[model samples]
Target chain A: MQKRISQREIARLANVRQETVSAVLNPNSRGNTRVSAESRERILRIAAEHNYRPNLQARILRGDSGSNLIGVLINARISQFFYDLLLPLEVELRKRHRRMIIGQLGNDAAEAESVLQNFIDYNLDGVIVLHHDISDGRRLFNHYLPLLPETVFLEVPPGVSGAAAVSIDFANGVREAVAHLAAGGRRRIALCMNDLRFLSMQMRLEGYRRGLEEAGRPFDESLIFIREPRPDYTFAELISDAVDLLAVRGKADAVIAGNDEWALALLREMNRRGLPVPGKVALVGYGNILNICRSTTPELTSIHHGMEELAAKLAAALEKPGTRFPPVLSHLVVRQSSI
Target chain B: MQKRISQREIARLANVRQETVSAVLNPNSRGNTRVSAESRERILRIAAEHNYRPNLQARILRGDSGSNLIGVLINARISQFFYDLLLPLEVELRKRHRRMIIGQLGNDAAEAESVLQNFIDYNLDGVIVLHHDISDGRRLFNHYLPLLPETVFLEVPPGVSGAAAVSIDFANGVREAVAHLAAGGRRRIALCMNDLRFLSMQMRLEGYRRGLEEAGRPFDESLIFIREPRPDYTFAELISDAVDLLAVRGKADAVIAGNDEWALALLREMNRRGLPVPGKVALVGYGNILNICRSTTPELTSIHHGMEELAAKLAAALEKPGTRFPPVLSHLVVRQSSI
Candidate 1:
């Protein structure tokens, strides 16, 4: 067995204080902790040479702990979007010397409650709830909300109270998407959404109406399609039915999907039905998932939801604690699907 | 505010010992602890009626904590496979009252080492390393392997020692795929793989050669295509080049992809080039990602890695520490693309 070198030895060898060694090794050490660059490099080099690795568990147990752990609560079903967001968020968190503990919330209220309980048990510094929804939303808001310690709700439902939030300006994206389609001479544009209960969806509906008004076009009730919230309602089937209702009967010339999955589903169904996209029925998607957008034959036009900016804001909020960050904005990314 | 009822209140009301009440609410409580069904139901119903929720945090802080925390470390990229596996594993873990903390490891060795350190700092009961790859494999084995506490490595690299592992037998899947193609009278079969450095890829290559030998066909080195590990290697371009190489030069009649993504990419490129699928170039993918396989035009033939079985095994291993579970087997799922 080899003898392990401690931070004390490294500090003595480098002619610096033990605190300087600690600050250099610590991930959460801020720039305010002044350590000369030459000393820092020398310490690091010596540590590397000696294969010095800190016993973080012993340090944490001894009460010399750094507040670097943050909990991220995500809805289990819609994890793909959250996962994409997490890739960047994790990198940013790493840069700041912070770590994330992810808790996947199942549809069952009890399970969701248990996850929240576990987060508290873990003694996380703060939490970020990504698309918060439990079976009983009222109970979550009324009882659980008060128990939450330094939390930030992302894409929060309407009328939820007493927490810092970083919400998406979905209406702004929807407006841009609608305006773009309308400018391309798409008069009778239809809207397809997954869930009407989500505040973002409601905002999109409002945006659709406003977009229509701006284009000097009347909003047709029949042109809108909202899928019933059921596990069996496949995205492809819902979009196929929506195409039949809007394109075949309602004579809609353009369509805007609630998200990229809906857009991809619409494209697949249209291709099956021999519908020429952009030539006859233009389509636009939300969430601007670049891979999915580019994968389609006629690359999908989508609303960019600024995931990087949102992640950065969430990280900032987590650090400051109790600070309410402004809502992240969205815009349009035009592609071949919507001309 | 309503008065919060404690477990003691429930126990007193239900005429049972506090230990019995503890056993009832504890997530990790095994079925061997015999409590009468009537007493169990009564305690549960009474607690529900009173809206009693366990204070897990206070319980943990009081040194009466159950070691139910499991840490899952995943490669920063290839998280989709791990995430899919996690969906089922989380459900299974919840049934046993265990919670998971995920640590994402980047390509950088230092970052990976740091994540491992954090996992230790958090005092996790056990750990699962999903597709473990630190830049220096030797350092991972030599230095970090000893530090892993009750860990199970999924799809472990070749020649790794001193850890319980559950590896997918990719060779069996590759052999099955190749034999199926051979039986369909496809003489010249090509194999496309990503990162030959992976033990699984090496196994697949061996399987390809063995499959060819079994079919009494000469092993052609020209039929194999391996891609360099680069971030920007898009699926479409990779498959497009593979198709050109095998179909044009090698004159291959069948192709087996390293994974489902590659298979789908090949299907797309072949479709664009107007090549008749099974009639001209039969294709098979690994990891039968059901949604992607079914989404393609002719559907896709793929290898079923048995994700559910694998997840179940992982959960069982986590429950009984130091027990090495048997390797999960893979088999072929013949879809339309392969005939």
Candidate 2:
């Protein structure tokens, strides 16, 4: 192992105070003008000779114990939803003079673990983990919780109690969406979801059952459409099959989708089948991705997951560690698709 | 500032070797079994008592110069394109046993500068700067190029020479699209772009002119449709106005858009006005974001930007620092919208 010269050693070699060495090195520092030009020059020369590099981690420990770096773990698959949460989180972090390092935790579990390990190795001041599923969240909590500093989970694992989290009340949002469809006198409502293995998908399913029971309608298992677990099968193919099951074969009057992307795709598929939305079949989607919802014909009706509010809560959790924030509630944004 | 207890200090306190202390501290270390249980217990006790935190930076400096951290600078505004590049880059980095820390350089210059500074402070091994525009790239180069280690520019600024870059040949793609339309007997071919201030957009405009000249057709300034610089106006509004200008007002027989998102929106806008795509106005788009191109009706014809190839080149640039990669050429994928 090669030994590197520290700021103290450099200061001693230059015959100047350690503070002078720090000021000369830090471009952002205002104290450089206070030091004599000759002293600054000497310190710079000695530091350059040894190829001195500032120890950011050591500086954090000695100065304030805050790295001012927040680690954000996100999955790139559900892009629009992830971006919604991330953009606002970045803004909120910037407001507190903090910078974010995003970890693209794709579908690979091993890759995801490495990303988490990297965060710990960096000794980040805080961590915000946006889970793809509850099981993944649980795995992270089991291994890395103690090692992580000031951790905030966007979707805390199901049974991991008392963790700092900012969660969406998807169950309630879907429930309201279904009830709205039911109140509109639509019978045989269909629910379209991707991968029921996900805790979020399970929550939405539960909400659908409750909404049906509340509306005095029977909860039929046949009415629920889950995406086929085939890698070659596109979301378009899934939507096409879903449109057939709901509108063509099953003759379902209303449908609720997992996200706006799926719902918009479904809308196009239904249009191809000559099924007029809100007339032949009413449609609703979760994650009111505004641009997507607006650009579609007869603009989509969606459940507005309050990403900005969730970001604020996520930031607040970091600020006041151990304070439990209530789950961020979602609201139904009625549009022509549901009218 | 309180002094941190190093591995040597812990070893001295436990009356054991520094290797023993290191084995006791590192969970991933395979050397733990060689150390005696008594020594291990003593080392652990001393480490815990002192609240010893591992200095990862020092470990990097001592053992390996590479931090194994690659900083990726990106703008979150053009999300689909950004994600297309980022997901592949993450995979490529993972393949090389390196981790990526994404810096979302969202529209704020101050924020972008701070992100670059953070990358330097962390002593990242390599950096991949995905420029939003040529001017922004130049600004980054002028300020941080000398300070950065092993930097790869995704889009090298117009004038800067001898920088490792993975750039898209938008001019060639647009030129091919224009020539294709011209050969198909389209009288008026219009070009729709966003922010002509971007060198990328200007390159496409130049290509459009070149294509017109090659086909013995006069270049018309009125045929170019640039997005209005109003913050309140939505992209949908721009697409709607563009449809009116190209199909109705100008009676253009063909159109080429900035991206798939814009082309998809334009297709829908044209559809809403009872104008059939390709039959009435042949449409082409750049950045063939596959999912979007697939889902849209008549399936948009677009120039595929080859993000995977770009990612490979970017990773290759980091591996061989001084090597320059050729500009990644885009190819047009014909679909129903263009035919």
Candidate 3:
């Protein structure tokens, strides 16, 4: 395969000044630099011949990205969690007179790279990376952070730095929920969660353990229910089994669900089996997605995610770069389900 | 507001060929046209002095919009319908090696106008208008269709011509649902729906009426339940009232809900009141959103919207303009709730 030619190499090959090559290629920089139309066409033809793809990062770094376009990087999944976070983010960006163009990350590293490259090519003024998969998120973020300086990560890993970010205190809300449940004289409190693949979910589990310890209760593995793949068992059936074990067969009197959806499922299963929520078994859910939380039978107790505050902080960080933002705290919103 | 300067006007002012002006302003055209750097700079400076915003429509029409960027126009609402449609659309676009950029339409015409204008400015190759509000949707479609020739409407009104469309046959599914309920010995069936502000919803209601006529039953006005705001009533309360009126007070033995969420709410209420879903009152819902539909105790019977097919058709229409697409059909998927 032939080596790809750079703009400098194109300039050398075309016998024109490097600045002239730059002017010919980047339309944004051509305002002041005057090159003959003949030279412009010649440079373009040569660059095309050599298959010289412009390094979007270099081009972006060279000029002002005053496009008033904010790129939002989100994984492609249809969840209420994404919708709740994005609605406020879009509203906030619109308020700031900025247009949001979503860059939906595909499942692989190549897809992530291509999307990031597109963002650079489009010359987006700022970017907000929201809850990407933990497997490659750290690698991608560490690699691309320097190239795209005006990036605000929604929830970065513990130590990564050098860019603006608005972290969420996911653990705090679970701790509070456990303590609240404990204070209400509920014993054998259980934590129902999804698979512990994501760093955020792992953090929640840690919080649950700490909460149990703080409540002077021994950390019991039996009380930790993780939803995973089981042959011939649908999600509903799994939830039913969990309900049977925790509220039906076992002596568990309280539970903290991973999310509002899980909490609703548990509530429905409990209701189906003739077990009363808050009477037989109390339940608390995370991510206070209002539509789901409000529609449930008992108007589910949930942890407020502070999506609006997080959005505001993200917009502010983008608007004024290098400004330190405090971590957005998650708090328990006690409702009928957990009383 | 200043009248926007056309490329021809700028060409006349600069004493250059209109082609030269076009080549200078649009980067894509510069590969063939050779204009001196001096003339290029002069033309740009003159255009700037006159506060000329290059009529993106004229530029896009004159040359090629080889920007493999497809713009999806959606209203700024957080709903599952949008998510379902968009996921498939994105996947199909990606399969075609095209990148998708979302243009979220705000509440007003001005906002829609701005979003559409932004799409043009970004030089998007094609656009897909997906279920904009009825009030401004028609007006906007008529206005922008000429400028953006490579456009497709998801559910265009009858008699809307001259553009490729991949509409869903929403009425057919409702007709099927009503017929299915009637065939199962359901008499005095009720239609539960949101406000008939949307043309699509109105079509569903029409199908309901037609279904009743076909089933040798009279359309009862009392059985048509529209969810609207009443003072001192929450959404849950309104749904509870609908359930009472349809199943308890009235002689309606079956009900077809507007959407899955509404159906779920009704089912929950019915369960709370100790009413068997299909035994006493057969139930049906629209938009077979699997996650929600499958989670309900007696899995929801719903109208399967062929969103994947719709998305594929939209993608095809955009890829090859002038290709006519048949309207995507919706069908009833009978589940535990309606059996």
TM-score, per-candidate, Cα-based: 0.78, 0.79, 0.74
Highest DockQ scorer: 2
> Residue A226 error for model 1, in Å?
2.8
Query: Per-residue alpha-carbon lDDT of model 1 for B83-197, expressed as tens digits?
Result: 5786677666767777777677767787777777666555566788775676786566556666556777786666677777777777888888889999999989999988787
Model 3 lDDT tens row, B204-297: 8988988888888898888888877567778888898899888888767888999988898888888878788888888898999776676565
Candidate 1 has a TM-score of 0.78
Model 3 Cα lDDT, one tens digit per residue, A1-339: 123367899999899999999888876774677899899889999987765655433443344335567888876574666666776787789788777777777567888877776665455678898856645767777766765638888766554677777888788899899999999999889988889876678889988888888999998877878887468778888898788777766668998999888898888878878789988899998888765666566778999888889888988888787777778878999989888
lDDT (10s digit) by residue, model 2, range A1-339? 124578899989988888888888865555635789999889888987875767775566455346677888887665667766776787789788677777777666776777776777676778888864534656666656766778888777775644587777778888898899998988989999888766778888888888888888998877889875377987677888899887788889889999887888888888878999989999998888775676566778999878889898898889898787788877899998988
Q: Give the top-scoring candidate (TM-score).
A: 2
Candidate 3 clash figure, as a count: 4
True contacts kept of 1: 0.15
lDDT of 1 by residue, A1-339 (tens): 244577899999999998899899976665466888998999999998876766554444444664467778876566467756876776667677777776777677887777776665555567888856777865765566655557777865556776677878888888888888888988889998877777788889988888888878888899999886467876556777898998888888899999887887887787778788888899999888765676566778998878789888888876676676668878989999998
Q: B146-240 in candidate 2: lDDT tens per residue? A: 66777888777676655577777778888888888988889999998788877778888888888888989988877889885377997777888
Clashes of each: 0, 0, 4
The C-alpha interface RMSD of every prediction is 6.4, 6.1, 14.4
Q: Each candidate's lDDT (Cα)?
A: 0.77, 0.79, 0.78
